[model samples]
Target: MAELVFDYLIIGGGIAGTTAAETIRQKDQNGSVALICGEPHFLYSRVLLPEFIRKEIELDKVMLRTAGDYKKNGIDIFLNESVCDFNSQTMTLKTISGKEFRAKKILIASGGRPKLWNFETLLPGNIFRLQTLDDALKIKEFLSSRPSGTALVVGGGFMALEFIAILAKYGWKIKLLCAEKYFWPDFLDETGFGILKDLWQKNGIETIFGREIKNSAELDADFVGVGIGLDRNLDFLPHAAIKPPSGGLEVNEHLETGTPNVWAAGDVASYKDRFSGRRRSGGNWSGAFMQGRTAGLNMAGGKESFKNIPVYAISHLGVNISFVGDVGPFDEKFGVKTEEIRFDKEKKEHIKIFMKDNRVIGAVLMNGQRFLGKINQAIMNGWADSKITLD
Candidate 1:
């Protein structure tokens, strides 16, 4: 066992941990900082993993920061260190490789591992879960061979949809099944989802929603990819602290967890949206980066607020989709001016916009052309509640 002390110890090398470290260095140049990441590669965007699989993006392009960048800032980086446990009383942590480190404050940005099926035996080699850069590279290799047969994708979300879109373009038989009736249910309403359904079906990808995967052993395919969501990697901490059992670490408006001197960020952390004040969980890259920066600033003895306007975006099947501010559920509560356009009703071209007062609170477009910059700006500038007169 080895012992060391630092001003801050960040557990997780993902975007959250990286941003936290950078933010800390930006604020306090004299304090010691250490970052522990399980993966050997530098910090990369987990959201772009699917796109990397489709060959639409190169590995180097999506990688934002490198380990060397952190080291230059005087922050110690530990790669390939898998944390096994943490003790708050001693302010120490033990890794699976039988190493120990002590610090003044710890930030758990370890993130989450993909949820895999609990099996009595090792599942077949064809099954895959895309949670890391290596996983995406492996899938890329698997697809390069152009293995004969269709892909059965399980789950419904931004990642699942992106996977289906990219894989379908590669000329592989694709069968997408989800347990929800609509795609991106959290962001898109029934009308918006209907538009996506039409586009997906038109592309020759069959989708079945609101259905559970009863058994995978009976099903056979050239390959299977599952995106059943993620669970917060909080087994090392007491369960009672984090409320809302569905999400990961729990925090107040300030992003502080139940444990003293322990803060959380990234997909592993859940907090209230600044606008709606409702508990929200976002596994997206933007959310993780922002949260990590806020946590780091706070940990470094700076007084900063974590409040922020909601932001989300994705590109699939030539459709660029983005959402900002309080959308969806807000449509019902707020009397927003709503407009919809369905081009070629039979062809499934539609776009819907929800404007509260005069600002854009939400929108959905599928197989249609509509620039999103204006809408996103309106939402962030607090113009969503203004009265508008369209030209």
Candidate 2:
């Protein structure tokens, strides 16, 4: 309804957007900043959503910042406003509510939304996806009824696994289906998956690896939950501005999208990986926050670049898991040493380390947190430059 001008406009209130806003404030305190979040609530950690479902944390504690906090930081907060269309040439953006705004610079930090199955169907009352806080609350409300039926969860990522673990604790008959050979194929190897497979069996949760849902009929449960994958939110913007294979707004090293006066971070922005030689999109909160900060600095006329140092970590039902650095399939072409380790019979934990020239390049560990800090430090310290003889 009204047009407002600001030095920088951030289009998301997730980890990336909020972090970018803070970065801009830190760099240029004098510049006017505006943030528009589609969700009515303030930012919360998506990584800890599962914990919230498990009742590990309270709902009030999940909120990352309060409205008063934003006002204290001198940021204009606009809630429940999703940018529908953007014009690069005119430096203007229109929200779904038909409000228009102009800014000297824009940061598209909008995060990903959960991909649903059979989206055309109108069975929203029973089915759900755990992407937003509202979705979590809905699921919790459903569970509060103590439904005398089983719940089926689809997908194989951390989200699916965490849900399975939580539901199992509530004595719900659970069926978890993953259409992959391993639980987290991007981060785990066969040995690590074997460990998780054992854990799932011990917990009495059904798992179907390397198999997918052929149809909705195949899911025989009280409620069918499907969140098989994630997709970018760049559909609101023009596709010509993006590069290929990313399905994300293409950004340079500095998080600068080719679009004039616009940048992006988090799950919506894609950049080439220096080590894997493949374009990468980030979904984790840690990387999202860092990328958001970098983008914010540049958009505020300061200097910043996102250096890729990807790390993935998750804990479920008291088991700790982490993966750091470049994890790749075993290949003789890359000249690497792959080691797989399984510890104990009762408490079997999986550990796999990928090495090149006798230095650890990547590692996957389950039920191990001590080594993660060391491995993370080793990777950051550039220990790959030195080679050592191993027994």
Which model scores highest in TM-score? 2
The regions of model 2 sitting more than 4 angstroms off are: 119-122, 274-277, 328-347, 354-361, 381-391
Per-residue CA lDDT of candidate 2, range 1-391, in tens? 5698988899999999998998889888899999999998888877777678777789887877988889988999899998899898899989989889999999998888877576317556677688898888887778767754788888877678767766876678888888887687856766677777777787777888798767757766766677677877776788686666667887888988877788989998887655444567877778898899889888878666688667888777668887766665444566766676445445656666666766666777787666666666655554552331121
Clashing pairs in 1: 357-386, 358-386, 359-384
Instruction: Report the C-alpha lDDT of model 1 over 90-192, residue by residue, as the tens digit.
Output: 8898888887889989998988887756531345577777888988888889889865577888778666876676678678788888888767775566777
Candidate 1 regions off by >4 Å? 118-122, 326-391
lDDT at position 254, candidate 1: 64
- Candidate 1 global lDDT: 0.74
Each candidate: RMSD to true structure? Answer: 3.6, 3.0
In order, the Cα lDDT scores of the candidates are 0.74, 0.77
TM-scores of the candidates in the order shown? 0.85, 0.89
